[model samples]
Target chain A: MTMLEVLDVSGLVTFQDSGRRGWQSYGVPLSGPMDWFAHRAANSMLNNSTDAVVIEIGLGEAMFRAKRDCVLAVTGTGFEVVNYIWTFPLWTSFYVRAGWRVQVKKISGGNWAYLGVAGGFEAQSMLGSKSTYLRGGLGSAIRAGDILEAGKPARELAKLTARNFPVEKFMNYSQSPVIEVIAGPQQDRFTEEGVQTFYGSEYTLSKSFDRMGYRLELLPSPSSAKGIAQATSADLLSEGMTLGSIQVPDNGQPIVMMADSPATGGYPKIANVIRADLPLLAQCEAGVSKIQFREIMLEEAQENFQKLNKAFKTPKG
Target chain B: MLKPLGDSALLVQLGDEINPALNQRVHALNALLQNPIHGILETVPAYSTLLIHYDPLTLTFDQAAHWVRDKMTQLDDSFHRTPRRLEVPVRYGNASGPDLETVAVSKGISPADVIRIHSEREYTVYMMGFTPGFPYMGTLDERLIMPRIATPRTLVKAGTVAIAASQTGIYPLDSPGGWHLIGWTPLKLFDPTSETPFLFSPGDVVKFIPLESLESNSLLFDQ
Candidate 1:
């Protein structure tokens, strides 16, 4: 087996896969990579399982040296890759020879990035996942001087160099995104005018956002409701809440659920972001980014979901 | 009435209010749905709703909805036996419970009286969430009702007991929280290494015993 030792690490970096499922009943949130689509794409390129453990880096650089020759792919917005004195853009698959030092510079585009090695990284799987949950203290992030073992033996020099690893074509990370949503269990909780405003006005992403939820600042409603007494906050019976459910607390600001969100919540959910758009929202750049929701029918949402699933199931060369 | 929470989940709601009857119904339905039933992946019981999450591929939304609706009709006929009860000991007030005075003042009672009232009642574990091992025990004595802190504390010690809005829970791990602290327990509510991580499951009965009983029991067990 080949191994990679971390010389230095920056920001919050952790080993994540598709996430641990079937444990929500135990009150464990499904904590995994924020961008599932990008993670899957990187895995597809390597012909590995989508749930393979990869290093999820957020805002910082790291230096790693391969003990044996290996094939790996780096996917995200952009991670600066330094090969000797040469620096190159990330998000593409490349081969690293044994004993070669690979350094990632500061993040260029997205807040989080994924680095997938062929055959995946090996770690202790708690509840069948190597994903780290910082809130539950389940798994800690990768740190300096940590040695990680790769699953399979490294390829020979000639075989490794001959392998062609290219980046997969995907949506642009820098574009302004529109997330589609379906009206929710509590859409009626908000005033009719408030509902109209929610779909009509553009809200800005707030600084107080995290893996738990993204808080959006309220924008002026074009058809604002006046003099309607705030509905008494109901003592909701906690229920199973999923990622992308938009919860509107008493302040009327919406908080979009994320991968690490709690299993249940008391706040009323006005809408749920469609499955196809959740990945786009996960890769959204922070700070004052406007969000507009377009109402989508359930049938249409399911159709899009099936299409994405079909795309994911197709064998990639 | 149950509503489709999303394409993958359905929320079966009993009532808007948190009545004891509604809670019992939720728990009963949760137990029935625990078995490997068709189209059901997991059944999560809460204060008044039971959320059933299923895979859309195996079970269509319409089929799952109909199955749940059929189950709801049988809820009234089913009989529930008394649940197993566990007595949990606690060291109340002082450092363990910083909000003891505040809770007492709001209830117009002495701190000692507050402890008496809390210990006298047996609570039901409504659900386990918010944090792992943080059991949402419900039906707290009306006098114990208190609002959560204006600003949540950055860190609350593990085993720190707290109460808020007719509910009581113990902090399973040291994490940021806002519930009014009332006591501490030595017993670990959650251990990830255990086959069953959580000590108490939904619908289990919980009674609070004093620290003196805990010490006496420990000595007896040692002998």
Candidate 2:
């Protein structure tokens, strides 16, 4: 069996796919890649199934050795790749002979990266997914000494250097991002001034951000008596939450829920990140990423999401 | 109330409370939405709202909204279906329950009386959340109802039967909690390898069966 053995793991490295669907009603969060665009870009280059499992490495160094020859691709920002002593750039696919060790150096700008193989990595499936949900104990993250089996490799390995992706033009993780949002179910709960304050001020992502959610620090307003936005009511009955839903607790801080958030939350949601911009927000580095929210109509949000999908669609022969 | 949750999903607030009637309506709508729609990906039903995750490319926000509205008219509120009943055996008091005496003292009743009242009632599953397979069953006997502990424990053993406010549930995983621990069940509430991971689903019925007396000071963990 073709396998990739883990040599050194410095930060969070776990298997991910399109996430566990149809299981949220059972209280299971859809745990998938935080940066969907990066994950898909890697997989699309290989022509692998969109749901194919790939290793999602967080901001740190990781090393692996290939037991058999296979074609591979890596996508996302910040991290240098060295394959068999040959340095390579990001957002492109390459071929490796057996026993070639691949090393990913520590990331500097972005928080997440995706490493996709020709077919996909084999993993223990639970609830119709191979995604590793750390809290749920469904699948395990990649650890030192673990052997990961790879699926069937491609027959042709030519044009490795010729086929390249223009990732710099589309996805830039180094800049401060303004996230577009759609108004929420509890928009009426906030005062008009509170809504204005949310859009008017820029916020910083706090150190306590994780895959569950990102706790944001809202810059204080000069006019408001209180330092933060005030809500008509602090709590609501527990309601269903989606990925990128910005929930505001009584503390007035807006927390954007990610892939592994709780199924239901009691805090009132102020806004939801547009699906198209979710990948951009995902690349925002914790504590260093400054973010702002811009409100848009639902139709515009939907149209933007469609445009993103169209960009990734392969040309029809 | 229908609101756009994000670019890809819509949140339908069926009601504001956690009543059985409201939950039934949520389930009815959930079942109707299960049928094939052009772009409906998945639907998540919570205590009071149903969030539908769909593909924006195939269906617009208005089209999906109108589709749900048409489905809502066909639901029969009077229709009743018998739910699967699960009887869970629990060991009450002593080592199995650290807060049993505290709960009895607050209720102004004897420990045995507290056990009797808790075991006799048939609780209905209001929802499943907080953790995987953790069922939130509710409307305990008024006299037995008590507030959650002021300070939640950092680590409570899995399968520990806990009560907070009017709802009672079992901790499917060994995690921190604030509910009053009255006992523990030996049954596994969540098993990842099982064909059916959860022993109970929303709209199911549950009954607690008190096991025979055990030697004092003997913890359930010991067994």
Best by TM-score: 2
Query: Any residue pairs clashing in model 2, and if so which?
Result: none
| TM-score list, all predictions | 0.90, 0.94
- Summarize candidate 1's per-residue lDDT along A217-293 as a digit string, tens digits: 75565453331123555655567788788888777778898889998898888889877677777766566356678
Per-residue alpha-carbon lDDT of model 2 for A1-317, expressed as tens digits?
Answer: 55688999977899999899877777888899998888887877776778888899886778989988777788887677887668877788888778999998765777787888877888889988999898888898789999988776444555332346676656556548888999888878887888887888778778787788888887555733342365576458777888899988877788999989887788888889988788888877766777889999988988877776765687211
Candidate 2 regions exceeding 4 Å error are: A84-86, A159-162, A172-174, A220-228, A315-317, B213-222
Task: For candidate 2, write residues B1-223 as lDDT tens digits.
Answer: 7878888888888888868778778877887888858799888777678888888889998889999988877867665666678988889988788899999998999999989999998888777778887888877888778888888999988899988888899999888899999999999888989898888787788999887644343523443
Positional deviation of residue A11's Cα in model 1 after best superposition, in angstroms: 2.1
Per-prediction DockQ comes to: 0.58, 0.72
Off by over 4 Å in 1: A78-82, A85-91, A106-108, A153-174, A219-235, B37-39, B217-223
